[model samples]
Target: MIHPLDKAPEQGEAGLLKRLLRAGLPVAPTVAVALEEEFLRLANLQEQIGLLFQGVFGARIDEERLFYAAERAESLVRESYLLPERAEAFLGSLKGWQGPFLVRDSGRSPFAQARTPQEALFALKRLYASRYRVEEVLERWPRLFPTLDLVLVQEAGAPQEDPGLSLKAAELLGQPARVEAWEGRVVRVILD
Candidate 1:
């Protein structure tokens, strides 16, 4: 259920982006190669569903929404990891919340303040599906399409005081392997 890059050495700005969708990319071309490749890997394997949704939710979660959510989760996941320096800014704003909670974004967007569990589920589905139009448009001229340039605003919200610090601190307290790895990123990211 774990991937090599899932636990990264990066955090904060280099770790996250708060950018508009219609602006310039914030990451180096060299770094984007890895990002895009991982993105594509998820995209290609999405049809299988189970491979993409593990660890995020329990096996007992609603099967109906999970299937559609997994199929559409790529865009939100894409939005979450896009670097601030690499992603251009345009349109509405999207901010991540905590513990599978995303909200209080640009008004008129479906993801903002999901009212009920049903609303939240639908919001996630719609949010993930948001990028299909862009990709479909770009599909015609794949060569002309810019990678990591256009980034939408959205986050896979998690419940935490500070995501990088809190989660790693929790891990540092319990997991030896994770402690050594996260210790450095915590110091480098939080103290530096």
Candidate 2:
């Protein structure tokens, strides 16, 4: 289900995004598509992972074969489209909002990559497809499967003088560190 940013779900990327927003950071309005929806779309693909490996290597699949199988599965998922209802919900959430929304994978490294409806769609698919990437398979296969639980669609933030801000949790010299970009370069780091 699609949940508004203010009502972000209790777990995963949605929660993190909400916390970031609540902290009064300059973030855009966001909505999170729950992990359950992604699980539904990807359960079949996950199930096919072993089969694909077996079909290629006759049941004794090595790391390379497993990776290849995962890649195949990711490709298939990339080819598939989001569920109709989810798509509708996504589009509906954008009502009254301006154009050029940014769609990001909540579970992965964040980026404001989508600037158009078509680009957003492709970004969403790519987010889902990232679950099956070779590195992902090498890291998570046999222990965990990737889930499509969190797609964050937000209003594209206007260009700012600062490129971005990054907070470091571990104390840097006994205090929290904040990195800020100035004039497109990391010119200052404040310890608070």
On TM-score, the candidate that comes out on top is 2
Top candidate by lDDT = 2
> Which regions of candidate 1 fall more than 4 Å away from where they truly are?
1-111, 134-136, 139-192
lDDT of 2 at 164: 42
Give one digit per residue, the lDDT tens place, for model 2 in 38-150.
64445566556556656433346476776778778778777766767767777777777665566666654354566665566667767777766777765764544654456
Error of 1 at 105 (Å): 11
Residue-level error in angstroms, candidate 1, position 30:
29
Error of 1 at 35 (Å): 16
Model 2 stretches astray by more than 4 angstroms? 16-26, 35-43, 54-64, 147-149, 157-192
State every prediction's TM-score relative to the real structure. Answer: 0.23, 0.66
lDDT by residue (tens digit), candidate 1, 1-192: 111112222322223321201122221110101234344355453343334444434545455654555445555443443333322211111112222223322222223434333344344334434433434323532232223221112233322224544344444333221111121222111221
All candidates' lDDT scores?
0.30, 0.58
